[model samples]
Target: MTAASPRIPSPLLLGVGLMLVAFNLRPALTTVGPLLAAIRMGTGLGTTGAAVLTMLPVLFLGIASVLGPRVSRWIGPDRGILLASAVVAAGLSLRALGGLVPLFAGACVAALGIGLAGVLIPGLVKREFPGQAGLMTGLYTMTLCLGAAAGAGLTVPLQDLFGGSWALALAAWALPAVLGTLAWAPFARPSRAPVAARSEVTRPVVWRSPLAWQVTGFMGLQSSLAYIMFGWVPLILHDRGLSAVDAGFVAALMSVGQAPAALLVPTFAARLRDQRGAALAIIGLTLATYLLVVFGPLWLVVPATLGHGFGLGGCFGLGLTIIVLRVRDAAGAAALSAMAQGVGYTIASLGPLGFGLAHEIGGGWVLPSTLFCALSLGAAAFSLGAGRNRQV
Candidate 1:
């Protein structure tokens, strides 16, 4: 008798697993912003140290992403993701123990998990939902924004409920990580196909492609802006005289605003002949709205924050969509995804660091605002090339 074929997960199971995993990607990063003041007060972390604390996770995200392809090859994508989720749970749980060392260490570990999932998920989307890549990516991105909003919006309340313990509030995110890991567990069984058969016949060298570089540039620059929102925006608002609760509320609102755009932009972009126009429009919107939030009348900050969120969300959704659109096969998508996020996020980590340093040195938001503008313009320049209807 012939040997039995390995069982594959149903589409429903796969879809649920994918979204749950996506939902775990942003919480660890987002929770920090709302609690930064409390964390600093408790740990004596200065502004620069706070920046480093924020920047550390992103830096490690980039470093870990570069290893994604290799890990997938060795363990399979399903197993890799399972491992990633488990690591994230452990990291978040570690954060609950308190102290500077635990906080930073936990962030690094959780970020490594997030980075691994980030690189692999796109390729999985390409492989499993080839016809619906855009929609699926939109859903994935939307889920990420929702997770971010939850973390931003709920941390303070959780802290208050837990007798003012920021660490406990931060640790609460681990529950989602655990759920994601459990959801993905059924799919992590060993495959009947040989490992070699799962890989590309001829792997594309993504690092050498000019178009790939443009995509990476766009991803990096936009991600810098996104991380800035996660790491410093609330603090910036607080500095501008908003109460902590109000500042966190605005940050949460920004993240909530991202969800609709995140779900819509990639779907719309995919139907177009090219995404160039969409890219330009969103980048302009992001830059304009961000400036308004930083400098416009306080009465208008809420609306500006929402607009900024929509712009950033659309930019991020398009960035992921471009990666899928630029590749014709799953292997190519995996390679491109690795390049875009690996080098891209390394470039991204500098944004928070730059903002913090600029604030410290210039002693005001002017210098940080200048840096934001420069980064936004650079992203626009690269998006022009990345948005082309061409395969890498």
Candidate 2:
């Protein structure tokens, strides 16, 4: 028998692939925020009522996640990302061209695109760079957060680039989506080992694992907090007398700050015996920041902003990193990622709705702030459970 020729893998190409995949993940969901004003005017949406619209993309992350593994099984992880990227472009196109119904519908569709690719790309890192999972995940995740920041920060400018039509603004995002999708076109032929090529496996043990719930719960609660920041922080700042632009800058800072945390937290998680101290510190800071943003004196904004930004980055990164680290192997890691992110994002959508309701019910920031504090405390309780040294 002839010996198989040696294969060469380019870290450069792989790194580029990782960044492209990460770039497409956030624009679908977060780009809405910077353009919320236009969307509100176009659709006649109020804050509390807009939750359905806001939540759709976030909620469907779970829905997309449900479809990811099946996609990887058929197409393999790398190819699956390409498919998802195209879906993102399609969804963004749909978002740009359609009216109100189309707008919300497109959001869900774009979310679906993000959702599948979201689950698969992490699996790609695990598959392609088996020896350097932590470093790869960190780099990939930092790109993801940076994409989020860019989407949020640039939406208005992008919209203005085309004579300021909301439709045009919304559609403007599709260009990047198309670019990223095209950029990831290489490595589409299929990997050597498809997920289904292995023996059929049922992981009821994962279902039975307490650590699974901890991971899921931590992912869910922290995600809720982060989404609240995404969906409402600007509004809160506006309430406190900043213009929409200023509030947006604050929100953008939080999203951007997530980059550092995404880069560092995975390394930290890898080193720690248990992640409890890290989790507690982040949770406490998040709580304190929320207090300052909602109820603290005006001068406290600077520190609160930093604390908020730092907490968000670490919490978001560490949550995903934990899922990957806690699992035993690539299969297990992929499964944990699917379960944590699928359910986690679905549950996270509740934060915006809850915050909106609190504002409606109490007629001021006090009630909403109190409500968030309670939620943050609940997250802290779960983090304690999740941070233990255990396998998912």
Candidate 3:
């Protein structure tokens, strides 16, 4: 008789757990931008220092992508995810425990936590919800968008609630971290015997295909643009005469805008012959956002931000779907994911750097918006090439 397949967690429980995990993903990166004034004032950090805090979590995320598979080898995937969640709890808690130096340390730990878990979740959807990859991917992504929105919107008010201490607001996220870890305890246990290798696992030979780099390049470029929005968009808006709260609202609105497209984009992308059309639609929307940011009427802010939210949100799921769809199987996909995330995140880290330098030189948001428009167009062009049926 055939051995029974291991029963995955219940669909509802799995979905809830996924949402909690997803919620943890954005707080480390997005929270600071919303509370930049508080953080800068409280910590006495200059713009460069604040930017490092913003960029390092993402940079470490890329680093964790390269490290995740080895981690998976040590612990079974489920147990590995549990371990990563524990890291999240530990990492976020680090910020609560100390001063400025510890804050950056916590960000790095949190980035590593977010990065490793970020890489694994797609694989989990493939392994546990194989028949429903499309649905699960969309759901997880939407929850991620929601979590990002929560962190973006809540950071300021939370600071106010706790007598204007940013650290307390930052620490408050630990509650979710603990809850998610507890809810995920069952799958946290390792299940399989380790595969013994007679020798060290060699680096798998890579197929140096243009398509591979193109796929990775798409991720890198899109993420570069996304991080600029995350890191500085609110501040830029505030400079243009919006109040700090209004700017935060706009930034939060941009993230919330993505929820609809994030949920719906993957379904269509999964059904498509390739991801080109969906990617083009999203980038095209980004171009529109640039137009509004640069020269549209004042009333256009809402629509432009909404388009940005939807496009960027949809792009996240579509990008992940492309990685899965383009690869032949799980191992190849994992390897490609590692490459894409590592390279992509490294490239993306340039965004905030570029924005700051550009603003310093040009003295306003105008030039930066133009530069991003060009990047958006470039993203559209590359997405067309990456979204092919051939293996990347």
Candidate 4:
């Protein structure tokens, strides 16, 4: 007689735990930008130093993602996720302490947790929710968008609540991570031995696959554009005469739009035989965002931000979905996921810094917008190859 399938966690518990993990992935880094001005003033860090603090976590995210498989190997995937959640909590808590050194250290630590978790989650979805990859990806991505919006919108209010202390505001974000870790605890045991044994025998040669590279390129390019928006879009609006408050609002609104788009895009993408139409849709929307940033009217900024966020969210969701679609099984999914994010994020880390230099040298937003439009086109080209209905 066939052995019974190993018991999986309840669908409700699994999704909740997954989304909670998703929720913490972005807050650690995204929250810092809003408080950068205050942080600079409080710590007496120069512009260059502040820039490093902002960029450091992203750098580590890309670099540390290569460690995901190894970490999972040490502890099974379930326990690995638990460990990542704990790391995120520890990192966020460390940042709560008052000092420049702790602040930088905390960001790196948190990003390391986010990056490793990032690599593992796609594989987890593939293994645990195999039939609903698209739906699950969409849900997790929606939570990610909401979490980012919450962080951006709430941090200042939280700072005010704590008597204008940015440190306290930054520290407050750690609470959700702690909650996520606890929520995940019940399902955090090591993967069953039979599943682990099967995974070891079925590893995919992802590094040598051209389709895998295309997926990785798509992931990298889209992320590059997203990080640029995260770092500069609000500042661009502020420079164009919007108040700091209004600029932040527009940025947060952009993030809010990402949720619905992320919620819907992957579902549609999964139904299509190939994702070219979906990818072209992304290109079209992203192009509109750049145009609005360059020349849209003040009254239109809100809608423009909404459209921008929507396109970004869709692109991001599609990128994750494609990683799953292209691979054949959990082993391939894990390898491709880790490879794409490890190298993809490293490539993405250049976007904000390079765009900043370009803006400074060109003395305006015009040239930078032009460059990103060109990069968006490149992403579309890569997506064409990646979106093909073929397995890696």
Give all candidates' CA lDDT scores.
Answer: 0.91, 0.76, 0.76, 0.82
Worst lDDT window (10 residues) for model 1? 194-203
Tens-digit lDDT string for candidate 1 (179-247): 999989988876445433554422456777899999999999999999998999889899889988889
Q: List TM-scores for all candidates, in order.
A: 0.97, 0.93, 0.91, 0.93
> Candidate 3 residues 307-383, lDDT tens each?
88888888888888877777655555666677777777887777776776676668777777777877777777779
Best candidate according to lDDT? 1
Backbone clashes in model 2, listed as residue pairs: none
What does each candidate score in C-alpha RMSD? 1.5, 2.3, 3.1, 2.5
Question: Residue 177 lDDT in model 3?
Answer: 80
Clashing pairs in 1: none
Relative to the unseen true structure, what is the Cα RMSD of model 4?
Answer: 2.5
**lDDT of model 3 at position 277:** 85
Error of 2 at 166 (Å): 2.2
Q: Better model by lDDT, 1 or 4?
A: 1
Best by TM-score: 1
Q: For residue 12, what is the lDDT in candidate 1?
A: 76
Candidate 4 backbone collisions, by pair: none
What's the C-alpha lDDT at position 238 in model 2?
Answer: 73
Clashes of 3: 0
